[model samples]
Target: MTGVPKILMTLGAIIFVVGFLMQFIHIGRLPGDIIVKKGNTTVYFPIVTSILVSIILSAIFYFLGKFR
Candidate 1:
């Protein structure tokens, strides 16, 4: 019923927030590429990672809802 959809929305929001936070809890930059130490080394790609994850999750939710 209506209650079920509300619960789904709430749960989806929580899942999204938790996933988003995972990218920031690290010791380095919030996401993006970063240079470490005095040497020349750059770690990249995580900045777009969070968005990609969120999009994938949302797509999954959307497809699942198509049957409901």
Candidate 2:
């Protein structure tokens, strides 16, 4: 295949693998993520998870570009 279809297939595979692994690995609850609780209110933020995802995506795109 060429261009968009190929890229879409690769991304779909990557997402599938990540989703499968998430069944056994709790990704959003990483230590560096933030959580706050007060009285009857609680808040959660996946800062570390977002950063990790950004880095992973950057690496994947970089390699994909190299191959192009």
Give a tens-digit lDDT track for model 1, residues 1-68.
87999999999998898779878865334555343554575545455556766797899889989988
Model 1 alpha-carbon miss at residue 2, Å = 1.3
| lDDT per residue (tens digit) for residues 1-68 in model 2 | 46899879988998999899989988787989999999999999999999998998899889989998
Candidate 2 clashes between residue pairs 3 or more apart in a chain or in different chains: none
Q: How many backbone clashes are present in model 2? A: 0
Q: Which prediction has the highest lDDT against the true structure?
A: 2
Candidate 2 global TM-score: 0.71
TM-score of each: 0.37, 0.71
Query: Which regions in candidate 2 have their CA more than 4 angstroms from the true location?
Result: 1-9
Task: Output the lDDT of residue 67, model 1.
Answer: 85
lDDT of each: 0.71, 0.91
